[model samples]
Target: MQKILGLFLFGIVLLTNIEAKDYEIKMLDMDKKGHTMVFDPPFLQIQPGDTITFIPTHKSHFAQSKVIPDGAEHFLSPLDQKTTFQLNQEGVYLYVCPPHQMMNMVGIIQVGKAVNMQEIRSALPKLERKAMTNKGRFLEYAKQIQE
Candidate 1:
């Protein structure tokens, strides 16, 4: 009986330690009704083990990583219906759609901490004009994480 109780408690602890979720980021057309030429939400805060599924609600849209945490892996979605990526690092991740990049279809994900903030800031200016517009927003989000 004691052994069985111990096993049950171990199972419960294992379940409690699994902290992962699937976040959705939709991609819309530039002419969409509600939101267009952008990633829905545009910004997200998640834990290190979280995953983000990028869904192209419209045609010709794909999510590609522009900047990621220093030791994190970069990702690029195929020009398909959806793409999912798991973030295992603790930092900021920036992504955009290739074809609609000029329209500023971009997004940022904050995982755990904004550790690579300086790199993200330095890389912002090199982005397109439309993407630069999001710099302030991203910086603001980063500040919140720092605090």
Candidate 2:
């Protein structure tokens, strides 16, 4: 009976995770909005366990995690290559392109609720300071975080 119960529980866990989804983001040099060095659709809302593929639509862009929820894994993709990141933890995730960071090549991925919004918010000032061209752009994305 004990062994049977353990197997049943494990099966239920797998079933719960079956609904996870996948998403995509583009690393762009310039978008229709006339912005440079940015992620197309710079802000994304997703659920925990979702996966995101960062495609380099232009060049010299990689998805590098800047801030993540505590216990969440950090990811950094190769520059100018397609890389996929799995978001397993719940909270807000911030990413940037190292080569064009000064041009404000940044983005946000909010998983579930903004469970770690305060921590992500506290880091915005530094992100803003590090930006050379698009001042206040980081905070602008942060403001879009709901709850």
Instruction: Please give the range of 10 consecutive residues that has the lowest summed lDDT in model 2.
Output: 15-24
lDDT string for model 2 (43-94, tens) is: 9889988899999899877888999999999999998899888898999999
Residue 106 local lDDT, model 2: 91
Model 1 per-residue lDDT tens digits across residues 104-127 = 777788898789878887876566
Return the lDDT, model 2, position 98.
Answer: 86
Residue pairs clashing in model 2 are none
Model 2 per-residue lDDT at 83: 89
Quickly count the clashes in candidate 1: 0
- Output the number of the TM-score-best candidate: 2
lDDT of 2 at 33: 88
